[model samples]
Target: MKAYILQKDSQSLDNLCLIERPDPVPGPGQLLVRMRAASINYRDQAIVTGGYFGGRVKRDTIPLSDGAGEVVAVGPGVSRFKVGDRVAGTFFLGWVDGPPVGRRTARGAPADGVLAELVVLDEIDAVALPPHLSFEEGACLPCAGLTAWHAVVEACRVRPGDTVLIQGTGGVSLFALQFARASGARVIGISSSDEKLERARRLGLETGINYRRTPEWGDEVQKLTGGRGVDHVIEVGGAGTLARSMQALAFGGRIALIGVLSGHQGDTNPHPLVMKGGSMHGVVVGNRAMFERMNRAIEINGIRPVIDRVFPFAEARAAYEYQQSGALFGKVVIAI
Candidate 1:
């Protein structure tokens, strides 16, 4: 089997080397997956460049947290799936169904990820993919998709008549837009490009603000909503845009802090949220239970994940480069 591995001493795309390795066999309660596709996330970039919270890995590791494949074999006691079952691995291998356990291990950095032809996943940490989704689409679900679901559906509980402020057209935000729309929420999106904004409009975005042109998008939000402000915010910009996010919140609204795309250094105030009775929740990619629920929702709503491009597995490096190029409006996938 051929797999890409990141060396501990070399943490850059230039160093992501693909090599042949022996096929791995699953142990008790595990499934040996023949990965068909994998998706890149912002976190994967951070891991590749040694900027993730844990720093450089202590050992060579496969990269990418999100992937989908068919079960080639199932270990003893693996009742959750069988050979030929389609599945996707969870982000956190151990935190299955409860409040996060301490320092939970995750894929693509602290542990071996799915950037390989074959990988082993615990039965408890893998979820069945929706039958309607292709492997490339399933690869988009484990991270960006689940995180968006956790924010729009779980944290904010966006409902019909509510307004959701999506930050950008990246993987998570686009997924949030789709989920919020499916839940009957009015979705507003902000992007640096008018073209991206226009594209978002086709995805049920009720309004689109070119934040580069309208720097005070919060004011625009207020105007769009007739001074009521948005009921929910998918806050991916972190401290850089957090003040504006607070200004755009409706009374008793909620903000789910998902990423810090804008560097984390900025002066941010919390008073506006306080005044608006707004609450903020930090969103990490969700657990297995949430993944299952999200899959069901995708199936029920007939939601298909937006893929900006799909690369052959041999072009995984090109996939990473494209994801980092800031030209993508949705997920970047590698077809294994």
Candidate 2:
């Protein structure tokens, strides 16, 4: 089996090495997955540079939380999956249903991830891929897809006539655009690049705001909605954009805080949220149940994840580089 492991010394791509290892085997309630594809996320870059939640890697680790493949074997007591089933791993290892509890370990950083030819997953920690999706598309669902679903569908309960404001044209934002559009919501997106904004419009974005051109885009959003503001804001840009998000939020609107792409520190006031009677929910990637529900939605809506590029398995490091290059409009995948 071939796997890429990030060494503990440098905590950068310089330390990421591809090596041969014995094929992983399934244990009790586990499934042996033959990984066909994996996707890079912003967090993967954070983890590689020692910027993730738990800081630097404590040991050599397989990096990446999102992957999809076929189940080649199932261990004793495993009932959720069978051989030949296509599946994707959940971001949080133990979050199968309900509220998250206990120590949460996500792949590609603290835990061994699916950036290998073969990997082991708890049956409870995996969900069957939607039938219509290929492995490369399915590989995207575990992180970005589920986070968008959790925000737009579960947290905001987006419905027809609702207005959704997504921060960028990145993976999660694009998925949120699709989900909100599927739910009959009008989607508005903001990006620094006009070309990306144009692409998002083609993806059902009702309006596009180039934040660079319209630095006070929140005010622009309110104007677009005739001063009513938006029902939901997919707030991915941490402190740098939270104040503007609050400004764009409608009365009783909900903002799902999913990332801190723009520096984590700032003096954003929360008084506007109180004034607007709005709520902000901090969304982790999501539970397995959420992943399953999102998959069902993907299947019914015929939604396909947007992939910006697919690199060969040997160029996994290049995939990571591309993700950080800021040229991505969607996901960067590794065809394992």
Candidate 3:
């Protein structure tokens, strides 16, 4: 099996080399998957750069948590799937249900991940991809799609006629917009690029705010809502945008703090949250149960994940570089 390995003291993409390793066999209750596709998440970049979750990596590590493939073999006690079943593994290997508790429950960290020709996972840790989706599309679901679904549908519980704000046109934001639209919510997408905003409008985004042009985007959002702020905000900007997100919320509005794409540190006033009776919820990528529920919604609604680019498995480093370039509007995939 060919795999990308991240070694200690390697901070550059050049360090991620494709190497041959013995194919792994499925352990008890697990299945061996012949990977067809894998998608890169922002977290994968952090891991490769030695900054994910403040953890250290000593051994060469396979990087990406999201992948789709066909089951090649099954271990003892594995019954949920059989050979030739197409499936994608959940990012969080041990978390099958409920809310995330501690740091140990995290996924896509230093652990050997799915950026390989083959990988093994527990039967319950994998879910069937939507029949209508391609392997590339299925590869986009496990991390970004599941996080967006959990934020808008499960955690925020966005209702019809409710207004939601999504920052940027990254994978999670685009998925959030699609899921919010499917749930009958009015979506307002914030981006710095007018071109990307136009693209978002075609994807059912009802309103688009070019944050670069209008620095006071929170005010623009308020104006768009006729003085009533949005019901929910998918706060991907982290501390840099948190203050404005606070200003853009209606009374009792909920903000799902999902990422810190902007500088990790920024100042935010607590008075607005208290005065407006709103709450901010920290959202890590979700669990296996959430991924399954999200897949059900995706199948029911016939939702398609937006893919920005597909790189060949040999160009995994190039794919990561592209993701870091920030020129893409949606998920970046590696076809294995």
C-alpha local distance difference test of each model: 0.93, 0.92, 0.89
Give the TM-score comparing model 3 with the true structure, all chains together: 0.97
Report model 1's TM-score to 2 decimal places: 0.99
The estimated TM-scores of all candidates read 0.99, 0.98, 0.97
Instruction: Tell me the lDDT of model 1 at 88.
Output: 95
lDDT of 2 by residue, 1-336 (tens): 999998884467998899999988799999999999999999988888898878899998988999999999999999988999999999988888887676798888788999999999998889999999999999999999999999999988999999999998889999999999999999999999999999998889989999999999999999999999999999999999999999999999999998898988899999999999999998888898888889999999999999999999999888999998989999999999
Off by over 4 Å in 2: none
lDDT of 3 by residue, 1-336 (tens): 999888765577777888999999999999999999999888888777776666555677777889999999999988899999999998876787876866643445556788899998889889999999999999999889998998998889999999999999999999999999999999998998999999999999999999989989999999999999999999999888999999999999999989988867766788998999999888877888888888888999999999999999988989999998969898999999
Off by over 4 Å in 1: none
Q: lDDT score, residue 269, model 2?
A: 93
Question: Ten residues in a row with the worst lDDT in model 3?
Answer: 102-111
lDDT of 2 at 272: 99
Over 26-70, each residue of candidate 1 has an lDDT whose tens digit, in order, gives: 999999999999999999998888888788877888999999999
Alpha-carbon RMSD of each model: 0.8, 0.9, 1.2
Ranking by lDDT: 1, 2, 3
The full ranking of all candidates by TM-score, starting with the best, is 1, 2, 3
